[model samples]
Target: MAADVRLSSLKEWDDDQVLSAMSEGNRLALAELYERYWYVLYRVAFQKTKSSEMAEELVQDLFVQLWQKRASLTVRRVDSYLFGALKYSVIDSIKSRIVHEKFQEYQQFFAPQVDSSTEDQLAYSDLLGTIETELLKLPPKTQEVFRMSRFEGQTIPEISQKLALTDKAVEYHLSKALKLLRTQLRDYSFVWLLISFGQL
Candidate 1:
């Protein structure tokens, strides 16, 4: 009888072989690829973000996206593909962090000023009312998921398990809710001002 080849042997295989295996829905191949590349990618991400948690999340998210889109993915050079993706992911994460920090700073700068004006107070109150109304307008499941994530401070996995929905479905609903809310509230200048200042 012939000895069976171990999956661990694939670690010695070249990128093309691994990519082909991954394209064929081989979970072992995916695992191998992850094991091989995760540390390098994590290092790159950490160097870029300078936040261990953010770097870890970014790398994990990349793998998740890769798995989710594996069916249609075509890679000639796995190293180039993965490193390129990581680079772009780092760039996007940096951009998002910058925007968030700017918004937070803006909020802190204007928070003191907003409290001094009766008109500003009324506008802020109205904005909150509008946001509540918009939240009510979301689909029941979407609204529940959003509320759990935002109000109850539940993580996506927690919300998914609690609602018996897949993580992707939960994320979809949350994205949809945000899109709708943005659309509904886009026309309000006061809301934009408040948001820019981190008031809302």
Candidate 2:
């Protein structure tokens, strides 16, 4: 009886509970997460993209992809994960439109969470450069997975279908590439800004 009561009480559910529900195709759980973070995500995206329409679009797209990839994703902290994903979405949106100087200003997105040193000019250049450079050093399969997942914005299922591998295998290669980037780019403080939510 108590368990049944708890099951009906979504407001009492933690992130893990919500995610577990999501894994089982629970639309209500997805709605809970969306209601919890969509506004915050939109605000962050708006600050970076400077466009309300763009911000709403990125946040909406993120939720859509989150639903699409829920089974394959290994998210420990939901809010942190959403913020990180939104950062990449904002970058992808602005990547082709902005010059290097304007691009550096995008550091404002991470400035409050990350330190000031990472905002330095050299670090700014290396931040984007390092992502591309380290991306090239991975094994061929890992490289393809990283590009498809990160640069191309494909979900794990999509990559698995395209690459003829299981979703787990695709996730493994994607994780490997990100871990490698995090380790190899540890020197650049800017890299740390993206790799983890908390301290380096």
Best by TM-score: 1
lDDT of 1: 0.73
Error of 2 at 194 (Å): 27
Q: How does model 2 fare in lDDT?
A: 0.72
Quote the lDDT for 90 in model 1: 81
Residue pairs with clashing backbones, model 2: none
Q: Write the per-residue lDDT of candidate 1 for residues 7-90, one digit (tens) a residue.
A: 856878987887787778777888888998999999999998999998999788888768766888978789899999888778
Query: After superposition, which runs of candidate 1 have C-alpha atoms over 4 Å from their true positions?
Result: 1-6, 112-119, 126-200
**Candidate 2 lDDT, 86-192, residue by residue in tens:** 88767756652343333345456533454446456555565667777887888999999776665554556557768899878986886788788778777765544
**Which stretches of candidate 2 lie above 4 Å from their native place?**
1-8, 99-200
